[model samples]
Target chain A: MATLGNSTNIFWHECPVGKLERQRLLKQKGCVVWITGLSGSGKSTLACSLNRELYTRGKLSYVLDGDNLRHGLNKDLGFKAEDRTENIRRVGEVAKLFADAGLICIASLISPYRKDRDACRAMLADENFIEVFMNMPLELCEARDSKGLYKLARAGKIKGFTGIDDPYEPPLNCEIEIQQKDGVCPTPGDMAGEVVSYLEGKGYLHYQ
Target chain B: MATLGNSTNIFWHECPVGKLERQRLLKQKGCVVWITGLSGSGKSTLACSLNRELYTRGKLSYVLDGDNLRHGLNKDLGFKAEDRTENIRRVGEVAKLFADAGLICIASLISPYRKDRDACRAMLADENFIEVFMNMPLELCEARDSKGLYKLARAGKIKGFTGIDDPYEPPLNCEIEIQQKDGVCPTPGDMAGEVVSYLEGKGYLHYQ
Candidate 1:
């Protein structure tokens, strides 16, 4: 039989020591930097660039891009709309954990819906979340055709592909939108510097 | 009717650019360091200590400790065995994503069951996974009673308390074991050195 109205003391719970201390030691605050865009619009390129830049400066960071994530964590999850929601939901939860522990988390996904993106925003406080839009025209991404995904989608071969059979709601307001339609990307060095500068502006960097 | 088949060109789905090259430029090798122990066995202590050491050395690394994870990613998950299995499974999936993108993933959890630990081990290739055991005696852990969980278990206040009412299967094989029965722990500097040396021995740090 289960006991009713039983009370347990919270004091008995073992507390984890040194997490906040480690954050303080890092001197810069940790948060999630989510980069959203259409495929081949340069999300991964920007994310990798940013990760390398942070690495060079001795900042603890990791990038969770869409292709890599789908191949692994969300592999069992399918391309259905519900699955997409679940996919982003899982990533949001994981990113919150990463941010809490004071690591710079950069996740790049083709998360097309504003609601999904906003849900992620609600997971963390305003100061801890950064969203970057890699905005490039559909034609341009198709031209690059990095994975030939656009071609497949056009042939009705790949259903629910964003920017073709699917929809991508561009962010109305983003902290930064790097448009590659002009065919210019801030080098990984520049992009990293830009992100760090933002963190600096937010007073996240105290160690340096 | 659903037309589901193997991805026509699954191999071509690989990320166009290599992750290793990015890791090299970042000056770090991606790997997952999974630490398992009983509650109050200094898992978080050692995890943070290791993170601090890596940060100071300018290595890209992140720590996913047990409590913080529960606070976010696994917030809804309970302590039941099935829930625990799902919890570690999710962590393993996420850790695999981080490792694939070329970051050092350090996770410390009680992870009591050998089957659960083995599940995590199987998720990664042999070279990318390293398991460390924190072998502090149950009596010592209860004496410390860091979480007061031990006391609760003794008083019949808490059901299924690991190492007390619940069972904890020891690791059959581990990469390193911290024999802390005498209350001595390696300096963070030493542990960090060991990780770096292991990476070097595995030829993961050759970039200038």
Candidate 2:
């Protein structure tokens, strides 16, 4: 009888699979559209709108929003800085997989640190990453606190709040920046249209 | 002039929106097909077959495979129990999002524990979870040993394996069971046809 611990067993593992070929047949390129911004800057809104537009236009897309992700995928992760890094890291990995399957993944998160966001960007193929910055001013975001998060932070009820006790390093070269200045947000539809246009111009969105 | 924060905010933070509508539009109900078995039990083979079938028949479908997933999303997680649990949890969440988008998600993983597997099933709508047990015996899986993982586990080289160093609890009730003893492994074309036929029979597959 032959024992299982042998070198010959390992050689049997070599097999070539055509993942990219299948992706091409799907008629869309895989890419990650990462959305970074402060709270209430419409990151989730933009992400959701982009998803709707893509679905309506017959493009395969998925959204990874912060709150929803925490309820499931990142449930074990806390709001601590280190945990936050791991959270983004896991999400970045998942988004990469979605891209690999020939689906455009729209990821929306606060993602405060320049280093962390930069690390995520480094993990992907160059053309596959498009960073969208929700560039609303701090004062405006603080005032539009629907979740009462900024208010809690203001009263010192929350610790390590980005844009308060913590910092949010803006993307140095983001693809899109939806800036909210004097009390107006770009309509979610308009924002979604912008993302679709970007993908279209890049030849990512097409009717099949 | 109104400042950014003080403007009226309108966003539904907790709503399971468009899921049913999406199901209606796709004419196919969305669900996650969780495939579990020892490595080399032909999990990936079966999953690829189902995917190809869905594709040719023009149904929206995708597969969240272990090798592809480990190479990307779950890359940071090791074979530790905690890591494995987290890996399943994350994939479950992502699969839920895909289901909500009205796409059939076929997830292939060892997913060794009944507890962890059940946890994944609990995350979705009742009928939206299908557990498929690839019940090829351990000896047969070892004989095939497509990845040589079984040999590695037996040699004390890989810790926390599913069948050797670790355990795999069979499903109490699964939607499908593919056996390799007396029963036969379906060819890619046959498997695809069967899956399409089943989906059509269940009224979960639509062509509109």
Candidate 3:
């Protein structure tokens, strides 16, 4: 039952209130909108915009950004390689829970490793895991430098920082991609709309 | 900023759609119903029963028992002392996230340490963390031994088993307590009714 390192003899308990029933109540399919990109690529902005869009449409959605989680769930984890892997793993599991509760879970993270992201994708049904890659150029994100993180990384103050010292493995076959057109990046609303339309076309907008 | 041990320089991302809006959409206040008791104290039984009861009332509630989480979110953790503490902490954080998503989260765990349980309580507001103590006597729980855990513990096969080898510090001031009436253990429905009534009286069943 434990299925891993140490726990043993534990049994799985099934509840009567299952995912299908929750979906019926919410009137929308539950899924994870996983946004992956480099730092300063407006992942949080797109997440917030998508959340607002869903709310206005009478749909339930939640954003699992690092701000709320780092201070709480993943606070004990650091920026080490293993810590980052564990960090993404925990966030994936939490997102899965939010999805199971019949809400669209928007997870925005600068997850650099492809293996880690793939591992998270394996936790859910293939269709339920909607990966959205923010394919913005490093030059643009570094120029934005919204939080001065890029500067720190360039100055060698922050080692292994994503997009500077560490590599960001873009999603090979993401469900949606938010990229620039004619050298101009789209606004947060447009970016969110791109993902929303994908969700709609995929029949995630309604349960029935 | 990271509040605790390792994470640093992370900023809090505030979404436009918040708890109040989500509560309004769900028509119910979000909170955690934590059921704590001995192994055979019927915590999961009461949890599932209460979940069904809430669903019948058109309320959205999800149960986070070991059956669902230990194999996913907390699979990395074991039954070691420190691992147990981390286990409770992660559950508490996930419950907080569920509450923020505006769903009644039912968490069933045999968290014996008062301090660990209190730490979870401290994560949320004073009124939101409703601790339901299944105050069945140890002898009664041992006699039932639904999972044969007590028999194993008695045979010295399991060390540090709560209520057998480990100490189980009861809650000093819990929100609700379900106990035997006239030497007869209450049915799962009856125990769930006690909590449902409490939720009704406390105005958790509705939102303005």
Ranking by TM-score: 3, 2, 1
**CA lDDT of each candidate?**
0.73, 0.75, 0.90
Q: What are the per-residue Cα lDDT tens digits for candidate 2 across B1-208?
A: 1112211211234433366656665567888888888887777777877877776665667788755556556666666788778778878888887787677888888888999989989999767898888888888889887677777778887776778878889888988777753566656566556556767777778635
TM-score of 2: 0.85
Runs of candidate 2 with Cα error greater than 4 angstroms are A1-27, A180-185, B1-17, B24-27, B181-188
Return the DockQ of model 1. Answer: 0.18
Best DockQ among the predictions, by candidate number:
3
| iRMS of each prediction | 6.9, 9.5, 1.2
Q: Give me the displacement of residue B138 in model 1, in angstroms.
A: 2.9
Q: Write the per-residue lDDT of candidate 1 for residues A1-208, one digit (tens) a residue.
A: 1121222322212233334654665555778999999887877777777776666666666676655556556665677898788778888887876676567788888899999989998999976889988878888788888777788889998888999988999999888777643566556556667777887787665544
- List candidate 1 stretches off by more than 4 Å: A1-31, A48-61, A96-104, A139-145, A151-157, A180-208, B1-30, B52-61, B96-104, B125-128, B151-159, B180-208
Measured by TM-score, the strongest candidate is 3
Clash pairs of candidate 2? A140-B5, A143-B5, A144-B5
Question: Considering every candidate listed, which one attains the maximal lDDT?
Answer: 3
Candidate number with the higher TM-score (2 or 3): 3
Q: DockQ numbers for every candidate?
A: 0.18, 0.22, 0.80
TM-scores for every predicted model? 0.72, 0.85, 0.98
